[model samples]
Target: MPTDLSPVDDALADALDDERTRQRETLSLVASENYASEAVLAAQGSVLTNKYAEGSPGERYYGGCEHADAVERLAQERARELFGADHANVQPHSGTQANLAAYQALLDSGDTVLSLELRHGGHLSHGQPYTMVDEHFDVVHYGVDPETGRLDYDAVAARATETEPDLIVSGYSAYPRAVDWERMQTIAEDVGAYHVADIAHLTGLVAAGVHPSPVGVADLVTGSTHKTIRAGRGGMILCGEERADAVDTAVMPGCQGGPLMHNVAGKAAGFAEALTPAFDVYARQTVENAAALADRLQTRGFDLVSGGTDVHFALVDLRETHPELTGAAAEAALESVGLVANKQTVPGDHRSATVASGLRIGTPAITTRGFDAAATERLADALVDVLDAPDDEAVRDDARETVAELCRQFPVYDGGAVASA
Candidate 1:
């Protein structure tokens, strides 16, 4: 990494320094974010970034792609081994891209796709309106039971039967309950639909065995490498060998060109780290910390979606408890106190996504920084202080002090970044 950029590019260097400082000072509760290891960072910033390896390993379009091929192959191997998948494609630029490629490989144009409703915890790539997926495919949606705030699989099966979709997309962005992969797969089978499980948020948990894996059960498994996996900032697809070639072609010439070899190296490094026993412990603790945070928030009278989280994050439905406080306002209030989180839409939220009725707080980044349940509970209490009185500066000030103390106790990085002088 370029530690010193002062003499050549002071402006960009200063911005990077500021961002690093922000991360070190604040608490990150974003469900889709995590701190990648130093090894992963180094790999992404290496000379491999200059290479252009267009095709899969052993059949690159570029002439000088031997090392590039090696790194990509390593990433693929590690991803397959880590997830217990028959085939792995570590090339899509993002989780959305992975989903796009999977759809391209499996579904024809205008084929009906059944996915969870975005307002009820599905990703936009899962056929939200105006997106490429929605434009190309006939999209139908299923939603959680509003009364119970949980997915009703029986309802899902009914929806699938009614839609008779060519593809069924499972997994979510903000639902805080465990998914029954087999049940979903069976539903898809009964309808003669292909199952694509987008395990983006649960990648690390699944890899670490803390969450269930959909590698074998789902026809295609897609995920982001950075979320919980702490890998390179990219996307991957896993599938049976029969579908590997189609998946590869769709990702390469089908959607993207020359893979980001540097990111691939990062994926390889992170996956290697994930294979260690410590990652499993971290994964388990992340879920435990989320549960602890949820329990603390619940005791404070915050209504969590589905009652709590089974993974690394919790979705707090603020509609019933604080009817007037919008999720955007809550997010801003928490950010004022140095606690970073995101606004989310609850099962039956009537508001727009930007001003939704929920808060999504996660523990992956905090757990990576060595925080346990006790520390998470304390943070949860601080969050409550901010949410309970968003307009109260005195409360926010107190919460900031608590946040600073916690930052001191658990620093994100060992040392500060060196800025160019």
Candidate 2:
């Protein structure tokens, strides 16, 4: 029972309450989602949202931007400290926007851009045919090694040599292993292209020093603050001092206007939290829990991409073991039992993206709820049971019970009222 909302707009308030209940009672395994802290949430819901600051800190298009300036500066300083970057722009509305601004800053229209194939784990903004980026740029794609389900630097190098793209994009949404940022930088350098690493999915891991940082390696780095960092829903760009002005102008006048000041406050708060020692433990536990879950899933006869994971998530390739099960069906069955996850495309997926051949399971949200390796192992068992007998009501009933018990044991958000059965 939180305050402020129940007194007004009961309809929307009830919906919010229901969502909170759902979050508390279910295991959130989405790779691109995480729960923001109360401090971060408060900051996001603050009155700062009413303000409009159209420019950078200290230099604004409107008056009464002193507080906005302070918040943005704090966010930028904290982000720079966390990622060891000479510059950080905390204004992009989302990770896609951040990447868009980066491209706009570094490359000209019709410039050749090389990025990973979306079906093979890249993001849509990297040059999906339907995106505005594709309409504006000449995009080429590289892919993972089908046999290994991992990137082959030599193959990427060969492609770069042939295409000679103006920009090379790295980082991914469904990749379970760590990226070799230095190798990507070398490839871009050899081809005389700028390297833009989008660590949207691993921002918090990198901030906690659990995953390797691309701050100094890549020519430009962009990420979403909400995914792993648990900040407000927004994006950030980090680069060297040399590229700061270009990125600033691109983000401001080029892609968007009026920075989200409330989100910037949230980013400041979340970054402050990450600077503490407790966040280190949380980040380390997130990886360890994912590994534990993967090990358990593997033992249950599931094939994982790249064999296993080195981060907060694992991509379960079901093409071999459960050829009949599409990722959509698996996702639906799991969701029915309150195990929230997403369908994903494998390296050599034959099915469409909507009904992928793989499932991406993440441990960030569950780990944030104080779930350790043992709890994750139990979750893996429940997930396997549901997937093993997705059409069986008996199996779903049993799995639902297991999930309920797990939720009760590791509740979220001050143990908010559980959703009714």
Clashes of each: 0, 0
Q: What is the lDDT of candidate 2?
A: 0.92
Best by lDDT: 2
lDDT of 1: 0.91
Per residue, candidate 1 scores C-alpha lDDT tens digits across 253-286 of 9989988889999899889988999889889999
- Clashing residue pairs in candidate 2 are none
lDDT of 2 by residue, 376-415 (tens): 9999999999999999999999999999998888877874
**Model 1 spans > 4 angstroms off:** 415-421
List where candidate 2 sits over 4 angstroms from the true fold.
415-421
- RMSD (Cα, Å) for all candidates, in order, is 2.5, 2.5
TM-scores of the candidates are: 0.98, 0.97
